[model samples]
Target: MKKLFLSCLFLLFFAVAQAVPAKSFYFTTSDSVKLYVRIAGEGKPCLFVHGGPGSWPKIYYALGGDVTEQDMTMIYLDQRGSGRSGGDDKTDYSLNRMVKDFEELREHLGYSKWLVMAHSFGGTQATEYAYQHPASINGVILVASTLHLKSSLESYIVEGARILNKPESEFRKEGASVGETLGKVVSQLNEQDLMYKVMYPKKEMFAQMNAVMDTTLNWHFGSKVWDLHEYEQDFTQKSASVKVPVLVVAGKYDYSVGPQHYRLFKFPKATYKTMATGHCPYQEQPEEFGKYVRKFVARLN
Candidate 1:
């Protein structure tokens, strides 16, 4: 019995010592919805907000890992109703609610001030958040993000269609008519449609898009069509109030969000760069992307 007790004690200690830290946790929103968060590394805090108001935070794991290695405590948070977050409340997925969720998470983590790196739709959230809570943020990074929704989206679709080598006659005809009908046409296309084929050439990209689209559509709070008119006034009015350093990253081939939208942000303290890839620059060129981010953060230090 003594030997067995000693053996059990030893095993318990071994298990405790070998256990990987709890790198993730779930927190409740003010509305009582549960949200998931993953955190790693240790140093200056940097949170990576994902694109697609409904997309899971895991999409940034690779990039977060790279950033964390440089002594940055990287955080990836799934928006309400995405990934492991608990809530069937589609009605609670609005942009404002999402921003509240971000603020709550920041407070929960006890981060007095931290850097924010947001991608695509996540950029939209980060921009709005920065506008509202500039004092809480140390810096902001926008990746392939846009502000002028209608015009920028139109340009993105037309350019994307052209790159697919669709017949020029179809292009010329559609280009002229796209402004009025592009949203309808895009809505009709599903995860397996040819539109995605043109936009995402890689097999992995299709898988990623499908996952993101599933979550986005599942928890969409408002009209299927993104209405910038509702938020445009607020966005512009609040954006001018931002006083922190900002970095806007674009990809040359990013026909999805396009480059024109970046110009709309008139931050007095903003730096913009265009990469040689598409919507997802970090995945397309992780090493270069990581280097650029590190250099930017170094400047802040």
Candidate 2:
């Protein structure tokens, strides 16, 4: 009985020792709102901004892994009103406030310069952040992002709905509507139903979609009144004036924000590429995405 108890204690100790806890930190925004951040790896800082103004930082874990292997420090931040962040005042959820949050986080981290890797909506935030603070950015990697929310969301919905065999009338009616109503209709979709059936046709896509759906639902509910029009106006103006070493990456099957949207952006110096995958190309093809990011950053050096 003594020997068995000792053995059980040893097994428990080994299990606890092997467990890797995700590192967490906090940065206070200019408005005194506390923002949460997670960091991994070491070397030049590569701040990763997630899509959905309300998205959690965990979505970038796969990309962070790639950055880590390349000796790059990965910074994942949940924007205000997002995962583990403080913003009880929903009014604090504007795009300008979000931009300030990034600036404050950078100041708190004590980084004079850093690279940025952002996805979908995160890409938009990254671009705006770079534009406002050009000297603070070393370079930028934009993955499946767009300047205009209307065009991007419309294209995504239409393409996804068509792929899912959703009725054209339902899409058309939703398209004519505005704001939270449109988003609500899109959010309540069953993962294995029409949208997933069409947008995610492959087995691997189904797996990825399942993961994305959970976080996405949380974000959609948390930020139900996201002002897309204001977001679009601000991004379009900022994107045209950016002069950083920008790499715009899109997935070939990304109905979310098609390549056409990237073409509309007036970046002063931008290199664009489309991967042979869908929206979350980093997960679908991490090696390729990492290779591209490494090559792009090298060019800046």
lDDT of 1 at 220: 36
Each prediction's Cα lDDT score? 0.67, 0.70
| Winning candidate number (TM-score) | 2
The digit string of per-residue lDDT tens for model 1 on 194-283 reads: 555434445576566555444333343233324434433334345567789888888776766665667678776888887876677776
For candidate 2, write residues 40-104 as lDDT tens digits.
66567888888765667566574333543364677888776776677664446666777787877
Candidate 1 worst ten-residue window by lDDT: 216-225
RMSD of 1: 6.2
Model 1 residue runs over 4 Å out of place are 1-22, 62-71, 163-180, 183-237
In the predicted model 2, the residue pairs found to clash are: none
- All candidates: CA RMSD (Å): 6.2, 6.6
- Give the Cα-based TM-score of candidate 1 against the true structure: 0.76
Candidate 1 pairs with clashing backbones:
none
Model 2 residue 183 lDDT score: 57
